[model samples]
Target: MVPSDGTAGRPLRESIRDKLRERIIEGTYGPGDRIVERDVAADFGVSRLPVREALRMLDTEGFVEMLATRGVIVKKLSRRDVLELFDVREALEGLAFRRAAERLTKRDATHLGALRSKARKALEAADGPALHGFNEEFHDTVNRLARNDLLASILEPLEGRLHWIFRQNDRPDQLWREHEELLAAIVDRDGDRAADLAVAHVRVNRDRVLSHLFGDHPEGTAAAG
Candidate 1:
């Protein structure tokens, strides 16, 4: 039970929703965990109305499900669902990499390098949350460099889902290595190579996650038992 500070400028319900979402991302409320409205409201020192509204919004975002008997439960992604999401992410991110390669300047490359450095340090420290934040910053930088708002809009939700999946992953080293390679291709201004690397990078992550979820192998292992 984490109490909200009640200091944010947003509406009460929105703030509650954001807090719950953060908890979900931080694995405080993991997949299949029950989210009781009464518990959440009591935890946040709020009424059930706001809690219900927040849960409804989270449901629409695919973060939770409201079942007849289960009430509200945290959403869990199946292997097939994860693979399909990776397919979409791979396509969009590949395109983003191609465009970013064409538009990337020395300054942009330097900025991306800084992000990669931060991510690498986070990985070295074994800080999963920090690594996730830096990873988002890196991809967000690439998306912005692509200079296509529509593409960014389309990828935003998918990126959120990917973030959720990534939090469940245990291979920060592999992920950072892929990021390093992708950044290298982008810095070299090799659009084709960057695009290909981006696709392969996502596929590798997808496979690793699937192997963990459905197979006997440990998380982050490429082999499926």
Candidate 2:
């Protein structure tokens, strides 16, 4: 369902890249799913050159794997890979929350509150996509409030992967509740509490995903036992 010709101002290759990435994120192109260049090019009504260039960009971004024989497929993350990403996210987002708490403005607090409210409504309605979108907006707002471009650059890709994981888990209620708690801490300007909650939230999600992947005993607990 990628747009065929809506990219007026942007470069064709970049537009194609974004469309493909969006499809991948929204589960249209799932992990290990083949990305045929000809099909993509035809879908987008573009030449193969732009499609290939777009795929190369995605390959460099670790979204897809390119092979000589097998061609291109969506990159599949292992359990270890997800855990490692969670570890990084815990550290980075914990820092982001702390910093955001220190500099949280009334405007930012109001925006976050609105986002939380919207997310809650989405959750109540059982609208998964809307809830996910609002969840991202909430987190992205926090990242922006942190006001660190470098941190944003590092966290953005991780967030993308996390979104994919979240979609797979199918449990948005707890996540929305966590977002509510996080916003409360941020609004209170409690940096320490905010940071702790952020880390714990990441850990909670990590456990949820791992548990879903590995049955009743997650890899971490099984290893420790």
Per-residue lDDT of candidate 1, residues 1-225 (tens digit): 334444455667778887888888778998899999998888888889889998998998888999999999999876666767777888799999999998998889888877877887888788876877777667778889988889988987666677777766677666767788888988999999999999888877777777677663334433322
After superposition, candidate 1 runs with Cα above 4 Å error: 1-9, 216-225
Choose the strongest candidate by lDDT: 2
Best by TM-score: 2
lDDT (tens digit, per residue) of candidate 2 on 173-206: 7677788898899999999999999998987788
Clashing pairs in 2: none
Query: What is candidate 1's TM-score against the reference?
Result: 0.85
Cα RMSD for predicted model 2: 2.7
lDDT of each: 0.80, 0.81
- lDDT measured at residue 152 in model 1 versus the true structure, 0 to 100: 87
Model 1 residue 178 CA deviation in Å: 0.8
State the weakest 10-residue window (summed lDDT) of model 2. Answer: 216-225
- What's the residue-level lDDT of 163 in candidate 1? 74
